[model samples]
Target: MSRALLARNGRRALPLIYGGRRGTDTLSGVHLAARRFIVDMSYSAHFMDFKGSSIASSMKKLVVTKLSPNFREAVSTQTVAVPTPGDADLLVRNRFVGINASDINYSAGRYDPSVKPPFDAGFEGIGEVVGLGLSASSRYTVGDTVAYFGSGAFAEYTVVPAKEAVPVPAVKPEFLTLLVSGATAYIALKRLGDLAKGETVLVTAAAGGTGQFAVQFAKQAGCHVIGTCSTNEKAGFLKSIGCDRPINYTAEDLAKTLKKEYPQGIDVVYESVGGSVLELAVNSLANKGRLIVIGFISGYQSASGIPPFKGGTLPVKLLQKSASIRGFFLPHFLGDYREAMSSMIQMFAKGQLVCEVDFGDLAEEGKFVGLDAVFRAVDYMYAGRNLGKVVVEVAPPSVSNSKL
Candidate 1:
């Protein structure tokens, strides 16, 4: 006989398979040992019951408290009912969430013009499909590991629309790279930047999650990738990932280095660092060079707003060089680029592209686990502490071995 046993994690009650064993009253000497083993496994490990057919009633989630200029103070945790998927949606049990500056900006109520407070937080995440909506297509099934860079990722369980979820292999792909970071690097380079072979490419803040991916994509395009970072440690990582040159911006004058090293001017400038850096990249662009503006993290938390645009004189410089600057907002261009995500994953599978992700326990360095660690991850990024993509393990790296 079988019985449903509730777990401490509160996910759901598990249906335990065994002989007709009731309670302590019905236990014999040999049966008592077997019952005790089952009980220990049930109560101790959280996942045994998470695999239960019945869904969790409530889940842990981070919600925006109020609209404040400061992101750190604007959010708090709450226990909420797990959302059921709509007809075309899938119910995903999240394992990890990749932190980005956008999360901080969102909490500060900066980016989205119409966004208000008390909303679910986050964007990029990796998880498994636990439940499927009835009218949804069979393209995805329960237990399929998937990656999603969408809204409402700061919860243990988030509903992903069928069209947005990117299915991966049984062993999880480095979803941190395949989702947001990889898409930004691949799409922006091909569609907006128009990268070419043998051309010189400059990536600002190159040690960052998206920036590192940008460096690799630029290199893979046969461009000479030059990365700029604040520390030598970050610069070293850039070189290891196929960067041609890594300029320590804090140690060297970026403008002077660019002018002296490449008198012919740069061919493609992937300028994410703004202020003087943006202007400098524009000034150093070769004839017909294209500059793709990703994001300026230099002043994200600054009360004074965007950094100074001291690019000497923009009109005269760009007119002489015949170069153009275009801005890329990933949210504005998300769904249209699933093809790029697929390409990145295929390249990774072939060992052509190197995808490095920090999974807390998976790495030897700093670790950030669970929803509560998100704020610290943001601060780590702000402090330029991460060498690769910073991913928070909401659950352990893999859950397949566990009954859940």
Candidate 2:
């Protein structure tokens, strides 16, 4: 029998014939090609159990139809042939996929201009290894639960490089937070915050996903943790998570409160909000302070991509106080990924860390479930209606159950 291998990433189609020779080509960091089996017919044996059939042949996935601020309008679902993993890859049946504030930006072509429309969406996912290529079998076995960070995660299944997949203990959604949100906080604070005991660390949007981790990490570093949020409910949530001070910016002006309460100024600022809030963080820096900019969420849904900087300090104030602002883009800090993720996983398992996830299962306006719920989840996050990491359930327990 013959199987047709669909082309992806501009590569030509490569057909796989039973007991035939193999070929290979690489695209988007994954190898797509035919695999040669020692038993000649082991191909069906490797993939037949994916859905209790001889590989259903097709899968449903999300794709970016165009760039738009409206995430609901930017993406569309399509039924496509399941991708065959090359020797270095594992075909994963995605269970849950994590949502990020930057998803809208990616859809708007802000992350990579070279990428055109009709590209895959999503960055982090947790799944079970359903199929493995020859080389991947050495490191990963079918049914191994793994969490991966890459594009094309907004799908029922994702083909991830075995080297890039983190061997997880289970198919739980908490691990998804560690892959991206936890890593962002752990690495940024450890490397750039230069945190010290008794110092004051302020995390804006502290009730949100990555911000919550930043708050906890700062507290763990023996620093006095201060968190900023929009409402009293978020303030209470921050306090419950070890935040020494939870500033409700809406109840009182942020600048005035900082001047009154923290007259010495904030020692370190984990600034995510842009526009006026960013300016306030910059102006409130203490002597030798450092502000780590993980993202400008305020501008993510805007047309300009990034809000115009209006810091009064500019270069003169920073020079005088010896304060600095450092930007953190996770991809640039790949070296620290393993260490950061390992520590986060251990801490979470031991109950030393909390992984808050808003599965979008309970929404006042509407409930979210299944792949179709991604749009509502994105809208919920942008509306600041979510208190923690947002995620969408791609497949239920029946389909995502791992042998482990």
Residues 1-404 of candidate 2: C-alpha lDDT, one tens digit per residue: 22222222333323333333333211111222343332322333233234432356788888999898678889998899998887778888888999999888899988889999999989999977777766676555566678999999998888998889987778888989888889999999999999999999999999998998999999999999989998898898888889998989789887888899999998999989888888888888999999999999888877877887876557987898899999999999999988787778778878999888887656874655677778888888988878889988887765333353
List candidate 1 segments past 4 Å from native.
1-50, 53-55, 171-173, 359-366, 397-404
The worst-scoring run of ten residues by lDDT in candidate 1 lies at 25-34
RMSD (Å) per prediction: 10.4, 6.9
TM-score of every model versus the real structure: 0.82, 0.87
Instruction: Kindly list the per-residue Cα lDDT of model 1 for residues 1-404, writing each as its tens digit.
Output: 12233333554444433333323211111111112112222322222123443456898988888865456787888899887676678778888888886676688778775988789888877777766553442344455566787888988889888777776653253756667777887788888878889999999888877888889988888999999988898888888999999999899999899999999999888877788788788888999988999887777777644777876578787889888888888777865576677677667767887777755443334578878888777777777767777888887644344223
Candidate maximizing lDDT = 2
Off by over 4 Å in 2: 1-48, 51-55, 399-404
